[model samples]
Target: MKSTLAILAMAISVPSMAIAQTPPPYQPGMGDLMVTIVQPRHLKLGLAGQARNWDYADYAQHELEESLEAVEKHIPKWRNLDIAALMAATVKQPLEAIEKAVKAKNAAAFDASFKQLTDACNACHQSSNLPAIVIKVPDASAFPNQEFRVTRP
Candidate 1:
């Protein structure tokens, strides 16, 4: 009877030990957020602008901005540099320009502003010692399923 009780206690304790040793929730690093959140938004924004889809361009631009904000929020510091400060210094003005272009539905301005934004992105990466992570104006649609072109009803 004592042996059976000891065995049962050990079984219960084993599960408790296993639970205690469980790993913490996964926390995405800066690179993961950039690739997963920022890159796709940037690509979609470029495609929308290229296709002259002003409404979708506006939406994509906002998404890109939010992704950048989230990146700054999630990883406020990277390589000992303030991510928010870096973003403010590099991409803020270009994003504003892009916003203005999107609102105005001016394709030419959108193109120019998007280029400026892409340049700013590259500059930020270069300054952050990530020059190999080059960003550019999307020359082709990476998302084949999404229709970037404006459709008139």
Candidate 2:
């Protein structure tokens, strides 16, 4: 009877033990989430900035920041680029500059900062050895189905 009780106890604990030892969080690979989220948001922000749609630009910038952060947290390493530092050095400044220009309504500064940001994106791609993933100031809206126009409301 004691041996049967011990086996039952072991069986009951096994599932709990497994549950307690959870697996590490699932992290997508580099270039994976960037392509999925970062790149698109970056493009949208640029397009919105160009369109002078400052309201949507704010949201897009936040999303761009989040997307890059997600990449750094989920997939810390890329082919040769240290994503965290690269993001700080290459992407963050122009995003801030753009934010400032958008806030101040400085057309010239906005244009220059936007160009710098696009260049930085391309620079990052080149430095990461993925030059094929070229980024630019979007010329046209790919998301026409969604309104990008700035509304005074």
Candidate 3:
């Protein structure tokens, strides 16, 4: 009888212990996503363009664009600011211009468009009361593990 009671108590407590041990799902903030995904891709794209690695630049540009889209989708409204509208007004044209420059493989055009994109990013930050978050062209490669130079087949 005592063994039966012990078994019942253990079975009842097991589920509670499991529940207590389980962690909550991770929820990343807007800044977290930007720093982790968008910023790195933007830097890499700039590096690829500066290196005249058109193929890699094309891939990196698309990745950056997709990251922006994901950010807008995930956080349509942040702190009462409409992220989608802000992105459309500020970044859409610059991103399109960058895409055109990438497709044409025009380094000068890419540089101009990239500057526009960076300016738009800063503008958005300023408008959002985050003037301290200023983005610029990377002077050096942050990723030493990956090569920005194009490899000929």
> lDDT tens digits, residues 25-76, model 2?
7766776787789878977887787777887887887888788788888767
The alpha-carbon root-mean-square deviation between model 2 and the true structure, to one decimal in Å, is 3.1
Residue pairs that clash (backbone atoms under 3 angstroms), model 2? none
lDDT, each prediction: 0.93, 0.82, 0.93
lDDT of 3 by residue, 69-99 (tens): 9999998999989999999989899989988
Off by over 4 Å in 2: 1-26
lDDT of 3: 0.93
TM-score of 3: 0.90
Better of 1 and 2 by lDDT: 1
| Model 1, runs deviating above 4 Å | 1-12
Total clashes in model 2, counting residue pairs 3 or more apart in sequence or in different chains: 0
Candidate 1 lDDT, 66-94, residue by residue in tens: 99999999899998889999999999999
